[model samples]
Target: MKKNQVVLFPVLLALFVFTSCNAQKNIPVFSKVVYEGNDDIYNENPLKADEFYNPILQGTYPDPAIARKGNDYYLVASSFAMVPGVPIFHSNDLVNWVQIGHVLDRKTQLKVHDTGISASIYAPDIRYNPYNDTFYMIVTQFAGGFGNMVVKTKDPREGWSDPIKLDFQGIDPAIFFDDDGKAYVVHNDAPNKGEELYQGHRVIKIWEYDLEKDQVVPGTDKIIVNGGVDLSKKPIWIEAPHIYKKDGLYYLMCAEGGTGGWHSEVIFVSDNPMGPYEPAPSNPILTQRHFPGNRENKVDWVGHADLVVGPDDKYYGVFLGIRPNDKDRVNTGRETFILPVDWSGKFPVFENGLVPMEPTLKLPEGVEYKAGEGEFFPNGNFTYSEDFNSEKLDYRWIGLRGPREDFIEITKKGLKINPFEVNIKEVKPTSTLFHRQQHKDFSFTTTLEYKPKSEKELAGITAVQSEKFNYVFGVTRKDKKHFIVLERTEKGSSKILASKEIDFKEKIQLKVEAEGDDYKFSYALNGGDFENLGGTVSGDILSTNVA
Candidate 1:
């Protein structure tokens, strides 16, 4: 059933269809895609003048990391098993951002072609070092049999170098280039051999990094923070370590607790880059665990942050957070968010972060909030469309586990997809091109021209969270006629909700809309009025918890 579905677009367009269909050719063409974001929160509050919404890079973009090079700022997020791993963005002011590209775009760079959706690439850190004038992106890639890899380039726009594998046993690795021209790498490692006191008991280890060799020095490895801030309390899952320098002191910041409700960002300071660091008096600097869950537009799971100096000469932090629907299910995935930091005291604190978060920050004095300019991604309520007219596609549309080039082709007519035999239920990468669920209340409409030659062929739209959790709605053959079927897959078990027997000659319009927990799927034949297919289904299966 993976053959006919080709091309995915964030914006609603005349779905994937061409005037002519070659029976011998296996290509399924999608002309255009257009999507408009219309969440209730945005419509109520609205973007007034200089204000923008929280979760700047919306939809499942988690584990945010930031790096600054003079006036230009760069931000990145963990892509997990998505091909073109590690989505990157650029901005002059933190308010307006445009996606630059991805760090791992080539097939050789991403080896998750056969791995599970949640098994590859965790907690990526992007840093621009002034010493060698290079940008470094380091992370732990679990699939493809690689661990703790780092890649560098003089600039991010041109692309990145092949991985320079770090010889370490850990996850969430970050590199710090000191003012004295020295480099050090810090990461989360398991309690040594027999030292495992408890589950989730982990250690943050540091090693002197060789800039020229692009590897860690074997002899200088040392543990900086073992078992988190207060060993007596016994913190669990302390990871995502970042080192920052202010004046003469060095700060080691990491995400503490598990990535669930108790998740938080903690800080430690020391005189040396690698030393006996002391936890800050004000630990758990940024978190939402203390607030009530029923608050308006509540944001939870606040942790995994990276800091940078803003263009306004103030400190700012970018991290991951989630927006749970009325049912308290995380369907759209973890999103990247930004907040101003107060570093005037001994250590930095996320401003207004302790309170219920309303992340409409005032843009830096002179900068104005502009939406939909060039590649500058628009937040708040706005519309975006793609026609697949270009030779290269936007970075926002990504493939799962495998590179997009392997399955897609750009032609004058439209975008075509060569489906793999693999379905979305399996761990292997499918032919689906995903535009992560951006807004909870939104409409996705596509007019596609596809003919199911057999019951084995199905082509349409799907709302997916992972291989095991998703809603599959597409057109296939049943008996002698073509029928549209809707199936919901949860925890690897699928149930067919409804199937419609329809007669159509050329094209059909399909749509899936959601309002919080309720999701509806419908289709229109030959440009007729859209008719409902599967009444409404719960969107919880399409969302996930951070843990």
Candidate 2:
């Protein structure tokens, strides 16, 4: 397979769930798999039995949380403010994943109104407790206020129950079920002043949870691990906590040093689930902070991990990491990556024996996975075209805050976008639907056919870093004359970067290309050659750190 190849895969878009196999049934089972090679056609052949990709999931599927029930594995990620929040995926072999549905598909399930793009949902933990035959998802709503909530259901693909607001004070809530059937909610507790005074001084707390009462038992709350693995160093942001018991020893894992450059995963062990946990001798069980950025090795910010044991009795860690495009620009945001863990030692470590992360790995023995038969390039790079023929839209397409389905209409021509009263320049949700730029060197082309009634109404393709930072290439009407305009917004200020008058009947095509650390916007008429409309915009401006 060549390095520079773009494969386009066309699949069905739905409001519920789309499965790769057994579509007729509510719980679909895999029959055949698709292999994502560097080609336009799907490799109908099954995997070579020993090879697999690193990022089982691509694009902005970050902060992955996984739970297993028998042979079926269910996965969920932090959807932030995107509608149909917390997408759930089902996998048989843990390699090929298909989007079943979202946990919060209904508007009533979550309140993302006026929430910033990056300030809504944080790290969410999904756990299946067989004791009650229920799947519980505990997460934080970080929009207008800090809210910790939980939602559960027996079936994840169908839908989830309404949010049960909890009294937890902090974020990144996780649930652990002991062998004796006692359930506990462990999470990063906020710092109380007058005690430890450091930048990231925090503690991990646990409380006895009553499923029937749908609340935590009062007076059962206490700090289990204080100030991370070693309190002396005052490790920063000890968040995303999960507890597991193996060999009668309770192992508590949490992310430390924050989520950026110094992000890491550490572990502590205790005889009891509630008290006096000791740090592992080899702390920071997994990290990429020690390594310098290298184009050849693109994975970085590797932390926020969750451990799951497969049917093979082997342990695997699914965590979040970012892949830089060029010059350390992270346009794809955080992505989900999985690595086999070696538990031979007192603690677990990545078994890859490489720095940062490996792009490929050998699958566990006797595991077979089927690709999407027609799915393309599943190894991180994503390319898809949306004709919007169906009544619903693709799950990959995201809107700001809350999505307004009324703005989207299926027309005989194509998907029609009735411009919302607000533009993308505002902090509120808009009529635009966006897909993440999964690859650094890729192009996104969209056709817009609209007759603007007023200058306030303009439809086009936008590359957004946040509500304050974005770039738009749109067409607007002035005195019955159509014009192609390019605008860039920085720090709440909008500027018309460039503009050109175009002879428009009713439609035009807009294209956005990413080359290295810059983006180029171009427009064309009736499927003609694309002409550059504005100067290049630095991709770093839309990076996760800056945005």
Candidate 3:
């Protein structure tokens, strides 16, 4: 017999024997294991899939602000334009978290169509007022000129009150209620107040506010800190100011150096909450420590950090970082990461001063993975594909704004996205392939096969966070020619980075990889090798919306 025939005979014989055995037992058999991951992290301890399939929270976009009430710990993250802004996750131990609910649910709180992902609620700081026994959520809505919006609820899950606008200028408003029962709001100056022009820098200011009255002291705003040091010299866009009083010293922590590569710190201290604050002698509390060659070594875009004390009384800091894709550019969106913080005299001391944490660190203790405990995935991660035949959209997918039910549908073949009234420029209530920010550097490829009858019909892959900034890789019909294009739209301009004529093929497979600050695009014909389209694109295209 031929070599192929000989090999097939044994395989067929083994399959026949296995089928007979299974039939006799009257049982169905599956070769793949259902559970995964090691016991060290999860309770049952299962084999973990490849890293791409299994994403543990890491890097920047974490924007975690945790509040501990008794044994229960509540965590909130910046949702930007994603519907259900401020994802609220609950955890007994800091390591394993389950999504409990979202803070903003009412239609009055968020408009999914007009507000893009980056325009929704910016950085939100969650805190519990012990005296009144109430949960307060303070978020900066950038769509309304970086104004602070306040929402309070006795029960975070259901009884949230209407959003009350706090008259404050600045993005990333943090609320702090002092021991004396007085509440203060600390934030940066508004962008249009000429701060972005004079020094190209905004001042970090503190103002007393009455949550009950829903009003600030009007002109009571006082500048607590300003850009001055080497990292802050060139009109640094200081934002996300968090204040904590510990050991008779008031510590002011804020992010500086813009929100991109080479971004560093600007921490200051003041004995009193209002008076002039002094910058730390060793500022820039943290940076991309993994890169050691230059003082400004670039890796992850780390900022928007929150500090919380564990039940064990140890302090931990959670912030966002971007992990670049294979090309060393980050496009997967920012991710959250945790680091240890120690007090040196009066200032916070980070190991190696301002370096990024090593990939491997001691996992937090007292964490037990509770499978099937969350509102979405009670059993941990599940398999998901762009294929639309599934009954409902996976929880992993999030619309920049709330989407209408008619926007998308599934058939046995694949997902069918109905054209909406909006386009890429205008915030569309329904858009194809909308998802939350996952990792910084990851490859997202999809097979889109659509025959547009007219020039209005378009389909493709997009890395979109907001209406103003996004990158689209797809085929557009112009005149009678079908053009494969990679276009990036930012501010108000849509520029085609690369384009080519499309060949009528079975399907179009579009792949985008973001390294550090660069993006690579390629298209393949059926299962053939990917052909590069053109010149390299800067990673900055994504930086605008993400930060």
Candidate 4:
């Protein structure tokens, strides 16, 4: 399959028969079909583990915390207002990963405009302090509905220390430093406004901080854990805590109900690092127990974990799951997934704890770049159509907020973008033309040539997840010809299933393929034979935080 994959093999066999009829209706039945030189779809090198096997980091929007520093492992997601807000990823073996740089590129440390999509910086947590090698970080701007912030660094790559505010009102803070030195700081509380509190169902605290006086000691704020297990079952909105101690006891791990679906959940403990912490009679640990009549175990929003240990010491957790590929709108975002935690008499378990991250023979030893190997570019298979002349922007492009210098220019014959008018329903934080959701069953083609002056000068190709679920697929303008819609949009609702009648002046190529959540669109005109424009999407577009 060379020569442009044999001219993209009849458009990838009509998108592999509409992804084998949407994978026989929403995956699992031993879902298979991974391709390209398989070896379980390209041995774990930099974790694309054949495109997504229980998320151990896939693409787009990775979220809050995961750190390990001895054999090297670091992770720091949540790029909320996007521009270079947090990112950082490096792995020695926690199942391959790469990207290493980004922790709020100093715009005075984070501005986050309209803050949409669950309000910007929420839950960060990263730590590394070999007696002072330093590298603490603690986010939570939650649109500043209240305080919770901190940043420090010895050098995870220059510049950090700024946003200091921390009187702590709520929204995932976590910081535990004990060994003999003592310095706790768990979080989540800020409900009481007649209680529908941001759906995190409220209550769960633990203070005592003062990294040499950064604050939080006045009355020491400790409520260890509340919202009594099942008060009619509502108050489980505890946020992303994390506290680890083990052996002498002190566990804590958090995240419960309300990250969306399957009722999130992760709860943990043994306790006494400070408080009567208990809750672990095999608590929710994970869910989605095979959905058929279970409906993917009804709303599987599998917690926001983050433990670590491996290199053989065992105990690995990593969390975040969202599975509803297409049917009924779950829009694929929130991915990161790695699990293995047993413990035995103290209890932990989790192997089929809700099924999803399968497909692992063990890979992760390294050295295997496949897909055109090395320094990229046309050498392997990179073709945003003749490269589109890149000037910078290409870690496989990603922007849906934060990215300006006049949003895109690139020349030598392509990429222009420059029309910004905001209000695709009150826009949110800015930046568009996204990318990252790499291969959940690949194929995303692009080719545009607009010459419009009016009719809202639109252009196409989108899949997006935050303008509240997307679809788009080009060509508009009604009465004067040029039609060829697809639309979709959600939450704010806008449907256009399919459309026709075109002749938009000239150049047209537009193509889409997707696979998992089902996608297929085509066009050719002036190169010939492509047509098909009927639409079908399934669900999950990639941004319920981490995908």
> Per-residue lDDT for 318-408 in model 2, tens only?
9988777667767767788888888988888876523756676777777754544443224534346566676766566655666647455
Q: Show the lowest summed lDDT stretch of 10 residues, model 3.
A: 7-16
Report how far residue 185 has shifted in candidate 2, in Å.
Answer: 0.4
What TM-score does structure 1 among the candidates reach? 0.94
Badly placed stretches (over 4 Å) of model 3 are 1-62, 115-117, 144-146, 190-198, 228-235, 289-298, 325-328, 368-393, 401-406, 409-416, 427-430, 436-453, 465-547
lDDT of 1 by residue, 1-547 (tens): 0111111112111121111233335456665576766888887886667666787887777888988998888888888788889998999988889898999988778899887677688889999999889999999998887788999889899999988888989889999999999999999988789988877898999999998898999889999999999988989888899999998999999999877788899999999998789999988899999988899889998999999998889999999888887788777677889999999999999998899998466666888777577778877777777788987888878787778787788888777777666677788767777776788777777666677776767777877766777788888776889998889888899899999899998677788888887888898888799999979887766666411
State the RMSD for candidate 3. 13.5
What candidate 4 gets wrong by more than 4 Å, as runs, is 1-77, 84-137, 140-183, 186-208, 215-251, 255-279, 290-298, 305-321, 326-331, 335-402, 408-432, 435-503, 506-516, 522-547
Residue 419 C-alpha lDDT in model 1: 62
Best by TM-score: 1
TM-scores, one per candidate = 0.94, 0.89, 0.71, 0.33
Candidate 1 achieves a global lDDT of: 0.81
Ranking by lDDT: 1, 2, 3, 4
What local distance difference test score does each model get? 0.81, 0.71, 0.59, 0.57
Give me the displacement of residue 119 in model 2, in angstroms. 1.0
In angstroms, how far off is 390's CA in candidate 1?
A: 2.3
Cα error of candidate 2 at position 58, Å: 1.9
What's the lDDT for candidate 3? 0.59
